[model samples]
Target: MANPQKPPTAASKSSALASGKLGQIIRLLQRAKGATIDDLTEVTGWQAHSVRGAISGQLRKRHGLAVSATPDASRGLVYRLPKAGGTR
Candidate 1:
């Protein structure tokens, strides 16, 4: 009989996400000013949609990160993680 594979835990997924392009995006989001789609695309060499997907699919969905986007005067949408010790 074949063995079943367990789904990844939040810690493992977070560790995986904390490297490479995803990490880059996280860092940008952690910044006080946050980052726009253009900024994420520029850093990761990905299309705007791809960046959005990474945020929505990978960060928010997979990692269960409460990534939020707020409107900015200079930037259209600034995406970022919520402040530590802050409520979502």
Candidate 2:
């Protein structure tokens, strides 16, 4: 017989954002100015690649957030969530 699997609970999902570096990244990106890799690394102390991976793998895939990257004249690359009223 196959083993049964437990479904994901709300606590499990919420726990992912409860604390640590990933949570800090999400909060930083949630701001109006969003955040750059430099900003994320400054806060989380992770490498540039790790920051990108967390945004792509955890925030985008696992949390289902709409993460977009746009170029800035001064900041180079900035990552942010799309505006709520704008078209996806």
Candidate 3:
């Protein structure tokens, strides 16, 4: 049998959006001014815990995204993307 392909390299994967739950996280970030875990769930139709994983796991761990969450004045938890660079 042929050799199995290695997983995608960091450079290639970093620019590419992760799929499934991860995709939902990226899309929410791209679309919303500041997307919380709740926003991720609303967009992806996933549970809150899963949305949290998508932000903390896929976006932060794999893609090198900088994310922060804090309670808002009215909206409960609010998420910030990239944590640096780019204008909001």
Candidate 4:
């Protein structure tokens, strides 16, 4: 019988997340300006709750992303990933 496939390592998981809607969300968050729920919803065509779930459940809990949410005058709440050196 053929050997079973190896489980995905962190590198593989990250790479896998770099293509679909998950990737799109990450890209938006990685920007200097970050992104808003409206923006994420628009890009992914998902409801607000779904976007929140993906950020909270998938990115933070599952993938261990240090995503941050900050209050903004115009944007309300903005979400972003950390910069290279820090989780800012």
Please provide, for model 2 over 14-41, each residue's C-alpha lDDT reduced to its tens digit, 9 standing for 90 to 100.
Answer: 7767578877887788778989999999
- Give the root-mean-square deviation of each candidate in angstroms: 2.8, 3.7, 3.3, 1.6
Off by over 4 Å in 2: 1-8, 82-88
1-88: candidate 4 lDDT, tens digit per residue: 9999998897888789898999999999999999999999999999999999999999999988899999999889999997556643
Per-residue lDDT of 27 in model 3? 57
lDDT of 2: 0.86
Question: How many pairs of residues collide in model 2?
Answer: 0
lDDT of 4 at 76: 94
Best by lDDT: 4
Tens-digit lDDT track of model 1 for 1-88: 9999999997887678788999999989888888999999999999999999999998889878899899998789898896657775
> All candidates' lDDT scores?
0.88, 0.86, 0.71, 0.93
What does candidate 2 score on TM? 0.78
Instruction: Please tell me which predicted candidate would have the highest TM-score against the true structure.
Output: 4
- Candidate 4 has an lDDT of 0.93
Colliding residue pairs in candidate 3: none
Q: Total clashing residue pairs per candidate?
A: 0, 0, 0, 0
Query: Which residue runs of candidate 1 sit more than 4 Å off their true CA positions?
Result: 1-12, 83-88
Error of 1 at 80 (Å): 1.3
Which digits, one per residue and each the tens of the lDDT, describe model 3 over residues 1-88?
8999999886666456656656657656665567876677777898988778767787789667877676888878888675235664
